[model samples]
Target: MRNAPLGALETAAALRRGEIDVRELAADSLDAARGVGAEVGAFAHVLEELTREQARTAAEGIEDARRGGTLDELGQRSPLWGVPMPIKDLTQVAGQPFEAGSMALRGNIATVTDGVAQRLLDAGTLTVGKTSTPEFGMPCYTEPATGAPARTPWDLRRTAGGSSGGAAAAVASGVVPIAHGSDGGGSVRIPAACCGIVGIKPSRGVVSPGPYSTEGMGLATDGVLSRSVRDAAVGLDLIAGPRDGDFMPRPRPPMSYLDSVGRAPGPLRIGVLLEPLAAKTDVHPAALRGVERAIELLHGLGHVTTPIPAPFTPQEWAAFMPLWSVGAASIPLEAQQEGELLELTRWLREQGQGYSGVDLAQALSGVQAIARRTGEAFSAYDVVLTPTLSGPPAFPGELQLPGGADDFGAQCAFTPWTSSWNMIGNAAMSVPLHREEIDGTELPFGIQLGGTRPGEEALLLALAAQLEELDPWPLVREPSAA
Candidate 1:
């Protein structure tokens, strides 16, 4: 049981039956990770000793709870009890050093634990260790110059999408059922689409980032990437509480996200947008095919579909581009000057350095107005479905910083859809609903589904549950042990 890719629920069940002890599970996971992780490049740091300590403590505490009459027969004290999961290197887990996939931040250890990390601990999930990310989590491909570039389990040559590439790789490789990820732009969904998993970027403030967060940027959100919909739902519940001293709180959902999964999505009037906001970028055949397939699946599930032409123009995209440059530029110069910042970091910082402050303010204000404009478009439908990534998994180093302005220019061209949702601070997800034809080589291609503000759990997961029943990408076989 410990060797299998059991979900949070299944693990709890096995623990109740004594099929495997928490210690045995932790040890097996560590061994399996050591054996298979090298091939997939899923983990940045594997904490064997720390994981064992956590498992040992969890086992003792469960036993104590049994004796204390507080634990159930299933050992299900919480939705996440006894599950093995990985925290993305971007989030600070106390007592652990966070490299964030950059040499610049090497040896940077967290003196304090963050709210999300503490919440996972409180909910009884055993974190194995930190997964990888690109430098400052700045790119959609995880080929950080410093750390190991995380690759997809399906095709080793292809990328596991970044900046949450490490977490996505860990899940795809079956190192864990689910892993923590932060999505500023498409960090969560891009890799999830590339690796064939579920990535949910909840509405801003759905999961708090307090004591260290600035309010209302609409740029970043904390979430998870998981093998199954239920796994993501379970993890969200554990970490969804409001943190101390937060300015904006996610409106409390009336029910748990797990409960939302099995509920039928009913007949949703979905508006399909075939073209991205670009004037002339080629939509990958695989990506278009994926959207077509998802449309069929959703229609079979009884959802009404209407094809809507691209409502926003490239002019609007021009309005949005400066924000990306501004964000890229906002990388602290001190880090670049002092820390061992990667080439991409230094390049982005240099690019950002040229923007005027008024330019940033204008771009930000335009983005907010665009969000409102897009929200009005969404008012016409229950949901909108589109290809998650414009193409299938990019080959390793394909998205590295290109010489001249063309490098950043090309990146913006490739990933046009994901950032728009981030701009609006809506709940968006990439679901592994289809696999594109990549010759004989197989990699997951998925569809991006976006919900209106604060309707993330209802719009995305409910549909995801329906689709999961139609075509499930259950944990695939792990890489053969060497």
Candidate 2:
């Protein structure tokens, strides 16, 4: 039997106390990536040689710190030191494959590392490989035509969720304790909920989107997928900061996010909304039950839960679709390369091309209006609660539909509650608080928590940590080779 893996924080602590070395930890992680990760199709690439070299370098650096009597300080500065994690394929790591889950870019390697990837390297994390994402990260599912489908370790037939689906699978299946993920529109949180893990989507501008910030109109930001809230918080601290040319850099937090996890958030007003905001689909009972459980937990913890109207409207969603299509259209591709694009990507691109510049401007203005309305509505509460998805985890290929409205509509229905927070530019997370047996397999269901204000991730983390303490979720699933 394979041994359970230690979480990011636990691994860092062990390295600090000399309980384990970085090389050994990296080896174990690589083993899992090659073994269970392959079985789950969680990794798009595995850099065994690069990982081994990094482990040696990291182990040497730790030894030097120990000899200099600065090991404690090093640990304090880089909380994720010696941790093995995978970066989402959407982010560039120089010399690594930068396919972005598209067959057209299959052999392309990154020439320059993205700002987020550099920050992770500075934190002393060893990158095992790139996790799978959907083509251009336009879809919510991660069944890329370039490689294997990223499946949930909980059930191989089910999707891991995307475009950070592979990252969630790796974390949930013990291939790694935590993995780097990005959230454009529930990409991180959707997969986290599906795989029974924690996903953190920081407020807009909290994490820099440098070197390529204009891609998603600032809707997408890098985040983390991890087993524990504290791990996610530590991850936030590692990568949350302003770059030299950020469009709208957020101010630094008053305290470290890890510190916030321990502080008790006093009783505060939490608004619960069960209605689907953007999609005109009925919320599934399983999804509603997850929110109901979260409400009960909040009540028991001394916080008040009140039902609130959906702050977002269908009209705003109509405006948002054009912007999303425009994002897909913005990708620089050669005319001849268009045929290499996925059906969904091509459809979105075509839709984007059909919109006039006037239409694009109108859409942008509409998005701003939606953001203003959402901010005003959410100001009344400390946090907002909803189901992470409108339904349970989907089976492989279940969400795929014919190109155009059918595909787009199916995506929205599955992830009705997530994109609104992206539009609002506020912090949000998916916390796995409930599970149910489906076809004899226990599948995880998570509730979404949105912070009232931008850069309020600390508040969300505090509540998630409290809930974890009261009724802890499993850290990882049993050893699975699919």
On lDDT, the leading prediction is: 2
Candidate 2 per-residue lDDT, tens place, 156-253, comes to 88888999998999999988888999998899999999999999999999998886554357788899999999999999998898878777889778
lDDT of 2: 0.88
Give lDDT tens digits, candidate 1, residues 234-311: 777777767667776776589888888878876998989877774347778888888898899988988998998776
Q: What is the C-alpha RMSD of each candidate to the true structure, in Å?
A: 2.6, 1.5
Which portions of model 2 show Cα errors greater than 4 Å? 1-3, 479-482
lDDT score of residue 226 within candidate 1: 88
Best candidate, TM-score: 2
